[model samples]
Target: MRQSLRSPQQHCPARRQPLPVRNRVHRAWPVAGVAALAVITAGAFTTLAGLLVGPLHREFGWSRSTIGLASSVNMVLYGLTAPFAAALMDRFGMRRVVGTALALVAFGALWTTVMTAPWQFVLAWGVLVGAGCGSMALAFAATVTQRWFVRRRGLVTGVLTAAGVFGQFAFLPLLSRVVERFAWRTAALTLVVAVTVVLPLVLLLLRDHPADVGVRAYGAGEFTARPASAPGAARRTVRALLRSARTGPFWLLAATFAICGASTNGVMWTHFTPAAHDHGMPATVASSLLAMIGVFNVVGAVASGRLTDRFDPRRLLAAYFALRGLTLLALPLLMTATAGPPMVTFVVLFGLLDVATVPPTLALCRELYGGDSAIVFGWVGAAHQLGAGIAAFAGGAARDAFGSYDPLWVGVGALCGAGALLALTVVRPSRT
Candidate 1:
């Protein structure tokens, strides 16, 4: 039998080879890495309010309700602004959108220093800071996770979401010390400086897409195409809302997130320090407890992300909400003048639940909505903020009316129970 010596060119056409992880022109992790740091800096404005509210009340002779109204406005704007921020990021690029947001945060923090009246506080903290921070909200984490990593989306989401925990945990003690030692103005100045510093970093390192650095998303075998530029952001937002409103899952997710925001940002982050004060704890000690929660939250959030990659997200969310509810029910008992085992245990448990909801929630959004995940999550985030804003105001009002945060805690715990039931009801799509 004649062995036919075919020319080498007669072989089947070469298959496209994936670029090696090391030899790839650009990597996704660097972009995600920079984003994580920028996110931490962006969050500086959020945690200080609990510490500042008391000082502002004392210095300006304002009511707790009045101070809380400003925080409410901030939360509302933070939620309301997210869809547009997502839109802006889609159309204009991440660097420009985030850069502009940082500028707004700096201006607001700086402007807050000279505020002499309640209305000025509203304008600076409520309007400016709210809008600025909202523009850089958790949607950024979702956006980056979806765009940068195919293999570790859940884990990355967890880490990025933990950035918020880092901001609150790492900074609250320091900010409380600053407020106690100097004027509240000094604390505001610190926020301005921090945001200003992050601005240069965003410009220098952040890119809108992996292609901008010449590589595919991590684990993907090829480059993905850029999405079409968004239409008028306001118009797109309205349209997306209208379309998403027709779905049951959208409402379910939104409702659950609202509870999340109400429980965490609205009630706890905004009032926990003062509530602890009611039980005889000093501001420093209260802030330390909150900071400790943040530390554990980092662990919980990261772990949740890895879990989300492996388990049913809906189940994880249900368990997280139920656990959080139990913790909230126990919180009042632990509120004491001196730090003790009970309080320490509460901090650890609650911190693990804090922001751990984010990874599973985002994973579900991405799985369900595909390309629209960022915007859908943005609207859901709006619900979260709305709940947070309302809770902030309502908690203050409740405290004023009853002279205790007991009612607020009980009410939020009930809401968490409802959220757990809702999370379990979500119609999960089969994982591919």
Candidate 2:
């Protein structure tokens, strides 16, 4: 009777011992830092296409449309390779895939320095660099957030997306100055050096899963085991595309993202500097304006990420698209020979809206698809690149034929309005 009356705690005193303390700073944050660095480095190459168009035209007498064709190839490959790369990441791990991508970029940039023909440009810049950049695209960010974070996922996604855009735009002024002061070959070589420096850092720091470092994903209550590496990465990629293609949301997302790519990468990035030149603006000044958009983009993307965590993502996308459409429609009036206050305002507003679409779009992918969101996003990203490629070529051709980019601007603006409407139609799946 005395023993029975004793408390259960007396029988198992070990159970009352304090649990092991977790680290004050999670390893996920450091890993995310490294990933962002890699993304930024990869993104540094994107604007090179725009910056080189004038220099190449002056030296080689290649038509603007020809250089635009190469850029179109680059954009298309950059988009198409994303889904496959995401699958490859799942199978091989992030470090290896990203490192390999960096190597390809370095090689491609080096190759561009020596190429003499249009096909060589197509092969080096269009194929190799495009594929390399694609491997390190927005899909990589989605994968990092999916695997390493359970909390602040939206914020991290936004930061990483912004990192890529930052790399693309921020380096423009520097590269433009380099091209003006040195040769285009020197600018390409500079890119090669940047990529080579980043490759080792990625291999040394990037881990495939949180489990590799003996920590649970950030905010997870218990340690989660790493999943076994699945084989047939190509098959997995195809299967994902096939399954997602059957769904209504996938098509809507693809269509809107395509418009996103068209409006941003295809028209603006590929043509903005040349168009500014067409208006008598100095190349360096135009590049600086583009860089300004890059700087503010970081602020916009991170803020959008924070908002994504709190607000309805669909509404956020709808608003972003609408605002962006209005801005693009007004861009023609702002293009002058110099950067005025009105031009600066346009740059700031456009920069803020530049990649803001990414975070909410990723959010919707995860919310709708659950475990397969990253893969689904890859397919969606492909659509984005396709739209961008078409727009890039079309913008160049329009300028060559009609002697102005005004019509292209107005066309893309209308398409963005369509994207806004599409964003509203994406409803969450109903529960049983």
Candidate 3:
């Protein structure tokens, strides 16, 4: 078995220590750089998809089902790759993996500018973007949690995740306006430029660990023994996480996170525009509302991040699911384009729980999996994407079938209730 890191709050060997113990602090630059890259990349791809949805639909005459499938493919792959990517990071290093992933994203985005058919678009933009992002997704999140100061792990995760939501919120609208002003192809090319611009800064600023620079982990009172793996090579870190699968608490965490995915990005992100359109809301207006969802998602995610350090992650997850379900169920009753109580009520409540589960879910992964926490969380993240894939496609398919998203709204609400049960009853101290 691979060796675990030194126990929490432990210090490194004497010769390896950077400066006097008192001078060691987790440098902020590397993690900040990673977070910045995450925000821009996630924001760019999500916005690009939104802007292209109209153009692709108009150009190809493909049904919404066809378009939704592409996103589903992308999301599933994105989540599935996370564990492997984390494994790879453990082997190689973040600098190479992240840089390569960014390059792939850039290649995929630019390649889409030349596609003449829907499948071509799917393969290039959907698959490649998913692949690129898959390698980059929760790897960054894991690194932030593992490498940052312990007391601030929750806060760090929240802030980093918020960068992703902000990307969705801010960039989609900006790109929407850009697509309005320019062709969709031009809008896509712009993203390629943006990713390329960020790559250099990442290479220059990011180091996989503080130890590389002759320092202990950020705020770690003690450090663990380093593993024997090469500085940068991909391995089956996911297999490491499977050890926890035999237990109940891990299952509870997986199930709850799957619901987390289904409830938020799976349904809300995928179906919001079409659902709003069902009620006669224009697509762009619906998009703005979704972007608004990103805003509150940022808030909820940040708050949850702070909360994870103090509260039982299970309680936080259970509460998030209960609240999310209630809000989703209320949507058919509450949502509208106009500025009114039901609409505002829907926005405020649902938005609060949008991404609130992330911190607690991640914290619980560490609790349950211990030394293999990063890899375990990667698999859990994979479960989230799988739920996202199914729900994303299902939401679109439901819209295509029944002409509204009411059934999915109800179904997701029910799943959330199930998730709450799993969180409250199944989660135990050693199980995580």
Clashes, model 1: 0
Which regions of candidate 1 fall more than 4 Å away from where they truly are? Answer: 1-26, 430-432
What would the per-residue lDDT of candidate 3 be over residues 1-432, giving only the tens digit for each residue? Answer: 123455332554665565666454356546665656755575568555645656677887888778888888888888877887787777777778888888888888888888877788779877888888877776567765686456677887887777776676666666766777778888888788888778888788777776666656656777645556554333456356658788777777878888888887688777776677667776677667777877887788889998888888888888888888888887887656553667766877877787788888888778777767887887888788889889988987887898778999999999999998888875556443
**RMSD to truth, every model:** 4.6, 4.3, 7.5
TM-score of 3: 0.88
State which candidate, 2 or 3, has the greater lDDT. 2
**What's the TM-score of every candidate structure?**
0.93, 0.94, 0.88
Q: Global CA lDDT of candidate 2, please?
A: 0.92
Task: For model 2, name the residue pairs that clash.
Answer: none
In candidate 3, what residue range of length 10 has the lowest lDDT sum?
A: 1-10
- Model 1, 143-220: lDDT tens digits are 887778899888888888888668866888888899999878898898888876778888998989887777788899
Q: Which model scores highest in lDDT?
A: 2
182-286 per-residue lDDT for model 2 (tens digits): 988999999988977877788888999999988899989899999999799999888888888888999999999999999999998999999888899999999
Q: After superposing candidate 3, which stretches have Cα over 4 Å from the reference?
A: 1-26, 222-227, 230-235, 430-432
- Ten residues in a row with the worst lDDT in model 2? 15-24
